[model samples]
Target: MRQLILLCSLPLLVGCATTKTGLAPEDVSAASAKGDDVIWTDAASVEAQCNAALEAGRAVRDTIVRESASDQDVIRGFDNLSLAIDETYGWTQLMFSVHPDKVIREAAQGCEKSLSKFLNDVSLDRALYEAAGGVDGEQLEGLAKRVHEHQMRDFRRSGVSKNEETRARLAELHAEMVELGQSFQKNVLADVRSVKITDAGRLNGLPQDFIDAHAPDDDGTITLTTNYPDFFPIQTYAQDSALRKDLYEQFMQRAYPANGEVLLSLLKKRHEYATLLGYPSWAAYVTEDKMIGSAEATDAFIGQIASIARPRMEADLKLLLKRKQQDDPKADAIQVWDRFYYVGKVREADFGFDSRTVRPYFPYEQVRTGILDLYGELFGLRFVQDKDADVWHESVEAFDVYTGEQHVARFFLDMHPREGKYQHAAMFPIQTGLEDGRMPIAALVCNFPDPSKGDGKALMEHKQVVTYFHEFGHLIHHLLATRGDYVKLAGINVEWDFVEAPSQILEEWAWDTDVLQRFAKHVDTGEPIPAEMVKKMRDAEEFGLGANVMRQVFYTAYSFYLHHRDPTSLVLDDYTDEIFRDFSPYPRFDGSYVYANFGHLIGYSAIYYTYQWSLAISKDLFTRFQSAGLLDPVVAKHYRESILEPGGTRDAADLVRTFLERESNLDAYKKWLTE
Candidate 1:
């Protein structure tokens, strides 16, 4: 999913050099209408034009800062800056999308590397934050000041204050990391897609739909692809124990090729970069701006969750083992591949709730409406469908997000799967806004099963429902940002860890009876989810939670350990695998090279813990609405004012404090996990 999110900006290269004649936003819109001829992909022309535009934007931005300007002027200047940056970013991204070859990818990374220096020149702290302990009054207003502080901490943590030599070194390391990251991903995508099975009997335990989907010709066999949708179900359901073991080993070996070297290089560059910036490790560098302050804090938090979860996980395994025993009196011990399949079966037998029963009620359009209905009820905002939107894809839909009469922003919803498009759920900020008379536009990019699968019905599994709501949370944050004169202040241009809370909180909507009742209508029957079924759903909420939670903790811990620990002290081959050992009961699989494929360490660095940390905050924050009704507009409006609209315009911690009337507590998360 993360890999696909990286491709959303590829369309920016589709347009011509942005008209340099100081076109107004209206003029830009008029120009964009002549669309297909815009030629930003010419490598030579794009670089020269982009540099010129960036220089002009910088001068305008500086003037805004230096003049002690009027509110309106600052707003206008910020909007202009946003427009300039957006053009450059979009142009370069288009090239990468069309040509993801090594050369094109490198050039795109280089463009980003170059543009970053100009756009982020001013320290985020001095520009927006009050408590930055630097110069004062540079931030635009109360809201701007809050955003500045948040931005400032992020810059500081990212080593913006390093001396020129170290900064240069860090930049070089970043470029290398980008190259390696791309390489790592390309390898995994190819490796995962390359796996094949030649025997028909191998499909023995697999579902009829899966086997039918992948059936081979003359060979009388079915070949499996390593996509999560394909890989996970086979692991869980395949009756052939030997086949499961073979698949598990094959799956784990995804990083086995030159990926070990890739991981080592990435680790080395990260460590050197962190050390150059006076941080003890990359974890410290990354986590400084996150919810958890250090690697130690994260490990401690993981330990706290693990203490309760491990025991429950043991109990879960016992239940699964008993079920397997009933099948065959002399059955051997259950292994990793058997876990999901047996657990899912046990869930149906014990709790009587499974995804197949729930999926029919969640047609694509109804789920989307449910999301809007949930947000409208909670946030006092509405989304009106706009069929005339300038969408890049035919399957994509657009909407105008509104707060009463004011059109807050525009959102493009690309919900179905396609060739050349990314295959996951993610939010992309197509354009971020500013108080300076500019509005942001965002895209919710999701790869739901293609329409052909169910005769054009957008039937979604429960997991997909959660994913939809989650991505929409991010869209809400981006569209609702009413902060500074700059686009960066408008949306998720904040700390990574804090970013997930908004999205994760919305996932709770999928579980709520009150919320689900409004949107969960059967596509053919038009009936609501049964109350008894909802009860069963709630009763089974914590099912497999132990395994799920542990999986996240492993990823988070691996993220921290990889970035923060001293790479020189350990053998690079064992780096990523070693991190998983303490968290999981099993030892590391020798053949798989996970770090080679772990791309989050590229964009997120040491900050993958954001998901877990945000989950904690989400659990606590949603408790407020849980106490009220999920749709209680009064509390919803309060959330909009305190959290959603603020964007990066305020400290995430302070925002939570103000909204919840105190610091967010861990008790709620701990209880949720234990239950």
Candidate 2:
């Protein structure tokens, strides 16, 4: 699974030290303590909460504006206001994705629109900007100074100093962008496409457990959905090319026709917003604060990565194309539908491995427990299940994190797919940790195989196991990075491009033999995965490294190019084809509308290159463990303190340097690409 850090652009508001409303400190603490326990019962409840939060936020704004310049009370007032919005709008934004009920999710969307409008207004408030600017950076040190600088920077970026008319229009643009993003995501979530198989023999080469779980319906046809469990198995194992092509088309065209206009309008608005802020394009404006720093630099970095991987990609394509020719003597090129199947065949033929051979040892339940135990041992933390906790779905499980009897954080696992649920794996922040004893809350919404079906084993693929480790890395980042004084500086609030590194680094554990032996046991045989099989798994994993990197480059280019220029005359389909032809190793499958269902096009926008960018840093960071050992507690503790605990208090580059004792470089990434 691609790890998504869902940090909606809402400003991080930390806890306030004092409130001018004359409310007691305990009352302010109580207000900030809302977390996973707050449930939205209906649409009306969402609206009611939005209205209340806006009213209270306005009052806090007034109090901050009244404070004297250079007074510490101004900072407290801003923090109080931050807490108010986070407790209300932040929680609602998360509910919009994972809430089980349709009415509640829709209500949450409505609430998000209202909250976006309020945040836009707050961002443009010249009074608040002036008040924050009055703070003396010379009097502050560390996190406080960093937070003040960020507040000023965001204020300027928001166009708080623009003419009144331009500011009003900017507010309108922000609101529209929020609504369009919600529509784009909802269309993808609500639109779950499927393919029906009439002949059972079409399922040749699939694991028996998968076949058993997907038994035929009353009409003797097996149905497959675009969800990962069904879609991936068929693409990798099904012998019927027509079936694979049909499913691949459906999967790619997820929210088509509906989201077609929605995406274009979003791009147009984003471009206009950037232009209004005196930038040439959205890509230029968005990258200004990231590690890459500029659109030219982003282009250069992508070119560097593509050049490094192209040779390997060409070689990998030759091997896959050769495999395809065995089945079709006249075949000249690999189709998008043929890539997974042919890759699997090549792995088995060359590396003496098949992904299916390891499924029996990785039942869903054991993998979950094994990962929990692994993290607990490495981080000196404990996870205790909260069986009676309130959850949006009965299948959802909640756990509390403790460090030797001190409850430090809470997390929820909604690890299976259903109607109206988020269709991808991501970590949603429910509550931001505060310096004054408030624990953070986060949830992992994923669509893996559910054990409720068939023989109840719910065996997992090696890839899915790696995904689990990746997402848990995000959860652990949010839980451990709680020492910052401001919410914006705390948790996984690092630079947008750097957010995926910690999680990507954790994926290394999934490939380790020692880690797998602890939890990956045959469901029936009661035996651990053999060490030799793991060796084959590791070797087979490298078979498609070049093609995989190129595919990511294709996505990064698609996202960047769509926003780097004017979109009024751009045709979405033509643009997608152009990007694919330039960067992808495989030919584009006709009729596929990849952009319509690309959720990152809304959240990450032009910054989709962050994945590859962060992967480079992750590869460099993992060298610490490669030398010390995968499970070295001393290194883990040092990393937790240096990289995770500081959160966004310091620059991300500084954090990397602190951990590695040198500037981050592409040497590790280049080595991994060709090795």
Candidate 3:
């Protein structure tokens, strides 16, 4: 969420702005608003579509296997087969996620296992597997070759060559894993709880804007949910320490005691799956295809970073202790709830600045416009609003991306959190670009405070603004590329550890003073944030780097322990609490099962180290921009072509080498650690 550096300048060939309504006359005529059912339907309909896709895929495979087909024909058949099943599944999952209806989501879930099992069966088909392996990847070039190569590896990894008994077990394991992940995610999303606070006077340090935004009930109590926009302000600024503790505990225990069992089951299955695949652990299996190459490597990297981060964290803890003592003579320890509150106090005292002062300068619309425009200016891309396209929600918007006159990609922006919405910020790819005139589409889902809750415009905190930049980088990574094969070179198909680099790189833009001035403006006065305040903001960002780094280290370690250790012997609370005592400044709260709600256990698995690992790469890449200039089109284009466009066509390390014209070093990363 923090750390960025920049330099340079560029020329703009195209400059255009969209209407606030984001619709033109033609768009209005053609535009059809959509609801949840537009993409999501009953289980029967979804089952039928999945069956058709499976049937169609096999027919393509059968034709290739039976006919004396040329290389071109064989490649086309595979592409067609993949498109049928993949696009259908992608559509269903996307719809199910954004749809508000519980029935639709349940239907999607009901069909997921059956459909996935069928597809995995096809992936393990010996005829198709041999056909793919027989193709010479070097002879075919681009998408065709890459697709063949990837398919061959995938077929082997799917255990297509295994005996019937073992293969069946593998398939069962795959299906069970998918269900566990789905159930865990569902539990998190369905969890809705709010705490009602009655004492209005107790909200002393909180901004009036926050208090007014959440209207009190007839009994004069305000309800607080775990949404970032609403929750974070109170965590940071509220005077009532007890209330903050209550909220933090609830937030930590989300998806809860139930999910703890779910998580353990998942870990056990993952370990068994890895053992079946001839690996020591799931961490090793997952990292085999990533930059680090093994669990041992990742562990070493974590240790290297932790060594740098620990001392800085100790200093931060000392500073917090000093501040706590000032507030109370008897105060001796800093708890998790007290961390942000004291950090806020230190910023006010040290910098004479408040985050609220900066928030007014960044009205959501203007900030978004600025971010998009900045990207367009540097990247040679233009975005045309497709306001009339069918979307899951009214607040969701669509835009087609272009390079000159040719449409390159399209993306959806679901920028606000709502009831039954996906809570975390992420980029979800709908369709990735292929060489055969097919364009890519992606979604950027986030939970920025909805401006409509209070005013029609949201004033974003600097951190939230950074999250926008980060997530947009991901969308750009997904939308801006084409590969020889749709499945192989499509956006974000790269190694998980390196995939975060693009988005992480753009977060620097948020920290850029020149960039901030371009879009950050006061909703009331139209004045940009002062340069002096910008410097203060930048300086204040390093206030507690140690504590934050320690937290990440713990998360990374905790995940590793679950996947690599003996799950039967490991107790989740005991493992996490001990780690907290060792690395964290605060004592662990009793009965808190933070790991249960940690979505990474479901999605990221043992790959949480990627966040820190990618940050190193991001910092290295940012240094390239720092030297060449942040706005340098030559540098930006180099990044786009070398890093973004390659997708997964080349090794991630090779891509970095090509862009940097040298091997990436951790000097930039280590420097940032202590800074």
Best candidate according to TM-score: 2
Clash-forming residue pairs, model 3: 7-629, 7-630, 8-629, 142-484, 143-484, 143-485, 313-546
lDDT of model 1 at position 454: 60
Candidate 1 segments exceeding 4 Å error:
1-55, 61-83, 87-168, 193-199, 216-222, 225-229, 327-334, 449-454, 572-581, 585-593
Candidate ranking under lDDT, highest first, comes to: 2, 3, 1
Q: For candidate 3, what is the lDDT?
A: 0.73
| Predictions: Cα RMSD each | 6.0, 4.7, 7.5
Give the per-residue lDDT digits (tens) of candidate 2, residues 80-181. 566656656656766888788889898888877676666666777899888888788779777677777777777878989899899889989987998999
Query: In candidate 3, what residue range of length 10 has the lowest lDDT sum?
Result: 11-20
Kindly list the per-residue Cα lDDT of model 3 for residues 428-490, writing each as its tens digit.
Answer: 666656554567777777878676779877888888899888888978887776765555456
Stretches of candidate 2 above 4 Å error?
1-36, 39-52, 67-70, 98-110, 176-234, 238-265, 386-396, 416-420, 448-456, 567-578, 589-599
Supply every candidate's count of residue pairs whose N, Cα or C atoms clash at under 3 angstroms: 13, 0, 7
Q: State how far residue 248 of model 3 sits from its true place (Å).
A: 4.1
Angstrom error of the Cα, residue 247, model 1: value is 1.1
lDDT of 3 at 664: 92
**Against the true structure, candidate 2 has what lDDT?**
0.81
lDDT of 2 at 612: 89
Q: After superposition, how far is residue 270 of candidate 2 from its true place, in Å?
A: 2.4
